[model samples]
Target: SRSKNSNKERNLIRAFTVLDAYASKLSMPENAKEHAAYIYRKAVSKDIIRGSSIPSMMAASVFAACKQLGIPRSMNDTAKVANMSKKKLSRTYKRLVKNLELNVSSFEADYVSKISNSLSVSEKTARLAGKIIHDLKKEHLHVGKNPIGITAASLYLSAINYDEHVSIEKISKKTNISTVTIRKMIKLLRPFASKYLKSIDLSV
Candidate 1:
């Protein structure tokens, strides 16, 4: 019985150590960090951690916490910080979500504000992006798209509409998306956003 208890402690330490490493890199809020640790414990109690490696489980926990907390960290960003491949991290994340049946908050239009702030975009552009995302969501245009890419696309279009002189490459860098993906996202979304941008004559 003592050894069993000791094993649980060691597992917790290993899990927290891995979580702390990635959380520090992301500068995650204390609440989100604690929630992740708590979720890790739940996973252990459910025996969902059996087949998966500890680091992968830790990565998934923190990633889920970010989603639950509505943090704007991308899967690529999570992959980078966790020192794991994106595919692997995503697979683990999906498993955790499935087993835990976690009810993550959906990304809101206001999430654009967080993304814009991280990229240092102007407030005006951020508002425009929010409007764009809100409008797009009205018709379910963003349903299957990657959140970071879609947000980046909206911000890029908003900047152009506001005559802010920002480039897709720049937005790509800020959001950690490839320029190609942002371009594709913009291509589809631009038509829908055109009517919105019409009100502002940025050319002036």
Candidate 2:
């Protein structure tokens, strides 16, 4: 009898192919191959880095690799070098965290900063949005829920509350969330939006 190939087997083969391409592109140091393999293995084990989005995963993985190796590339620089959209990559990074169940919050900061940097806002604005999202999480807004939906909602609300001048359409376009959902989230936050706005510094 012939053996059957499962989805997992196909995914594994694709994963290896992606890793090979990534390693070739980076021309990573000889010793770095081991580190790359380690990270790739972890990503595969986690099952979040799909072959279709391997480039995005590779971008995040390279950032992770750089941090581990103390290579020090700025988020903006990495996004540029990777030629990936910062906002889309940020969303992918969040998906990676959810899939890996990682407790690390620093990557969240990078996500927010990437959005701010992309929107040409100050880092402070991003930090403020991060704070709002953190506070919301503590209040159980994210309880028993879809985190990506909650996060996209929270970020949209935060951008408006901070008076960032980025229209809802633009946020929808950037975050890839539906405009209807954005409007709904905005309306839901309306009563509290003004209150939140009063507390954050809007310079920049």
Candidate 3:
């Protein structure tokens, strides 16, 4: 049993390392990291890791942990860290949820702060971007959408309006979200963007 324990420890360390690569800038980095390790342990207890890919298991657990923790690492971000595709990440994440019966809760991503730190933007920018997200949520336009994309788009809008000069590509790489998705959200918010910006004395 010593051998098994050792392996679990090793796997947990590996999983944490992998998650840190992508989620290093999360507002509650330690919480997400510890929760991921907890998910790995629970999965191991269920013997769900049997005959499965280790990286995939760790990746899926991390993704579920993010969702369970209400953090902002998207499946795409997890896939990028694990070097897997979005489809595969989704598949393994679903399997992890099914096998472990994890209590995955509703998506309430606290991403503006995380993205703000990642971008090294000022607090004012983060607040304005957060206001954009809040506006979208109030309008019922942000439902069923990936938070990373929306956060990136919001940050982009905030940056440009505030003369921060951050680019779409930079946001994409930092958040591990696709540029296309960010742009789509940007376009969707264009009509309503002005109101939020105007309140903050910003122009889109």
Candidate 4:
């Protein structure tokens, strides 16, 4: 069984390489990276990694681990960092979850920091955008909605009020969300903005 052991070792090395590279690229925390490595090993034990590309499987493992850990990284961000198409990454992620029976807990996302850092919005504006998200959660308006779209819309609203000059196209590019969806989310958010964030006039 020496040959089989050697092949397994090589696969482990390759998986580690992909995981490490993507983790570094995404700035994943130490705990998250370790958890991803563990998930990769579990997937290997389940024999689900055989048909898929190693990079895709490893990246999918990371994504699943992040979801389990409530990390704020989205599929779009992870796919971009892994240098793979979102569709491929998403498919691989779904396969991993189904085959491994991974428990990916649902959690509220903190997309303001991610989008703010990506688009270079001011810290003050990011805080205001966070407050917007908090307000939505309190009002239960964020349930059954796309969190990233809501966050993008909130950041856009806060940026304009603060005169930060970030555009919808840029947010769409960074978020992999459509401008149309962002605009729709903005419309839903405007009434709340008018109520809580009174400094900005939504009557435009």
Candidate 5:
């Protein structure tokens, strides 16, 4: 019993170490980190951690926490920080979500601030991007879409309207979303662009 307890303790310490490393790299807030730790503990209690590598489990836990808390970190960002493949991280994340019965939903608007901050867009541009996201959301356009791609596309459109000169490649690099994905999202947003712009202009 003593040996078994020690092994469990060691595994927990190892898991938490991995969690802290990636969480720090991603600059997760303390509350998010705590939430992730709680999730990890729950996973252990449920034996969902069995046979999964510590890094993958920790990465999935933090990713789950971010989604639950509506943080803007993408799976690509978390995978890179965890030094794991996006495919593997995604697989692990899905497993954790299923096993934990977690209700994980995030929106494009939730990501506007993070992507805009990373790209250093002006406050006006950020607000415009946010408005673009929300306006589209009202129509349920963002449903079944990649949040990062949609958020990036909105920011790109906002920058153009504001004559801010941020490029698609720059947004792609900052967001770890593909230029192709961003372009596809842009195409979807184009028809609505004039309307969004008109609203912004009217407000200004």
Candidate 6:
């Protein structure tokens, strides 16, 4: 009799195939490709995930990519697509972030765009978040305590001010930050939000 493989094993194998394909087609910064490949490998090695769930793998890989490159994608949204537990994904995500030794000081516009695509948000929204991030840097704000944390905060601020209606709970779930931190970041940005919103509006 032949032995049967588990669904998780099958998923890992399928994820590896898809990631290998993505690696072949990807055209971007050298680091992006490397990070993408790293994420693919990580997902393939996970014991609980399945081969039929390539999209979930893709989501996890993309989330890893975002962290590795210092771009932010909401954890709740990403996990929803990936079908993984927040705690499990967060641990994996942090490990990747540490291994990659990513730079949070320098903003990567391309990586931000990729994250936006992964989250299925508009380029404009991504660009807005990127711009706000850039502006925040100018203020010499100590937002770098946690790159992903700040990035999520910035995006959430942008979303709320623009009437995008993304809840703090949702953003908190994705970034693994508390709702209090999210609220604090929003409060800190209140003075600048109006100006940033106006600028974004004019640019559009």
Worst 10 residues of 4 by lDDT: 195-204
Across 94-197, the per-residue lDDT of candidate 4 in tens digits comes to 99999988877563344667778889989988888877788888999998787788888988888888888888889887776778988999998876665546
Per-model TM-score on C-alpha atoms: 0.59, 0.41, 0.56, 0.57, 0.59, 0.43
Q: Which candidate do you rate higher for lDDT, 3 or 4?
A: 4
Residue-level lDDT of model 6, residues 1-204, one tens digit each, is 123446545655676566555444432244654676566655455432343246554655666665556544456656654567776667655554455443433343644554455455565677777877677667977444455555666676666556675566776664456788767776665555567674443121
**Cα lDDT tens digits for candidate 5, 1-74:** 99977877898999889888887899888889999999999988888988889899989999999787656688
User: What lDDT tens digits, residue by residue, belong to model 2 across residues 79-130?
Assistant: 6656788886677656765676544443445556655565666556666667
Mark the 10 consecutive residues where model 3 has the least summed lDDT.
195-204
**Between prediction 3 and prediction 4, which has the larger TM-score?**
4
In candidate 6, stretches whose alpha carbon ends up further than 4 angstroms from where it belongs are: 1-119, 198-204
Which scores greater on lDDT, model 5 or model 6? 5
Report RMSD (Å) for each prediction in the order shown.
Answer: 6.5, 13.1, 7.3, 8.1, 7.4, 11.9
Query: Each model's C-alpha lDDT?
Result: 0.81, 0.57, 0.75, 0.83, 0.84, 0.57
List candidate 5 segments past 4 Å from native. 107-204
Judged by TM-score relative to the true structure, which candidate is superior, 1 or 2?
A: 1
Give one digit per residue, the lDDT tens place, for model 1 in 1-204. 999779888999988888888889988878889999988999998889989999888888998997876655678888888888999999998988999999875565545766788778899888888787877888998886787778888888888877777877777766657789988888877777788785653321
1 or 3, which is superior by TM-score? 1
Q: Which candidate leads the pack in lDDT?
A: 5
**Could you tell me which residue pairs clash in candidate 1?**
none
lDDT of 4 at 203: 39
Question: 10 in model 4: Cα distance from truth in Å?
Answer: 0.8
lDDT of 3 by residue, 76-187 (tens): 6678777889998788788889888887864334567767788898888888887777888898998778877887888888787778888888988777677888889888
